[model samples]
Target: MWDLAGTLPLPLGVLDREGSTVIVGLNGLRLLRDGAWKRARAEAGA
Candidate 1:
């Protein structure tokens, strides 16, 4: 999820099961949710 509101840029880091670290982005989530994320998020927010 998007954390720390307003302008500027946000940087984040995470580790996986194997201890492999990687970066995440909104575009990735968009593509991952291309099937139904939009409606789901709207409903959740509503």
Candidate 2:
């Protein structure tokens, strides 16, 4: 098993009055085997 903990060195928030409800941040994931996982992508739309 493994665990990951990180901080977003910049500002990130979910504003309500500004008509925004999503904030993006970065995280690093490491596995015990040998592979690597980076840049988890996401999209928002109606």
RMSD of 1: 12.2
Tens-digit per-residue lDDT, 1-46, candidate 2: 1112334232332233233422221222233324332222222221
In candidate 1, the residue pairs with backbone N, CA or C atoms under 3 Å apart (3 or more residues apart, or in different chains) clash, namely: none
Query: Backbone clashes per model, in order?
Result: 0, 0
Error of 2 at 44 (Å): 27
TM-score of each: 0.26, 0.13
Which ten contiguous residues of candidate 1 have the minimum total lDDT? 13-22
Q: List the RMSD of every prediction in angstroms.
A: 12.2, 17.4
lDDT of 1: 0.50
| Model 2: lDDT to the true structure | 0.28
**lDDT digits (tens) for residues 1-46 of candidate 1:** 2333543333332233223322345445666765677888888999
- Backbone clash total for model 1 is 0
Q: Candidate 2, TM-score vs. the true structure?
A: 0.13
Q: Can you tell me which runs of candidate 1 are displaced by over 4 Å?
A: 1-35
Each prediction's Cα lDDT score? 0.50, 0.28
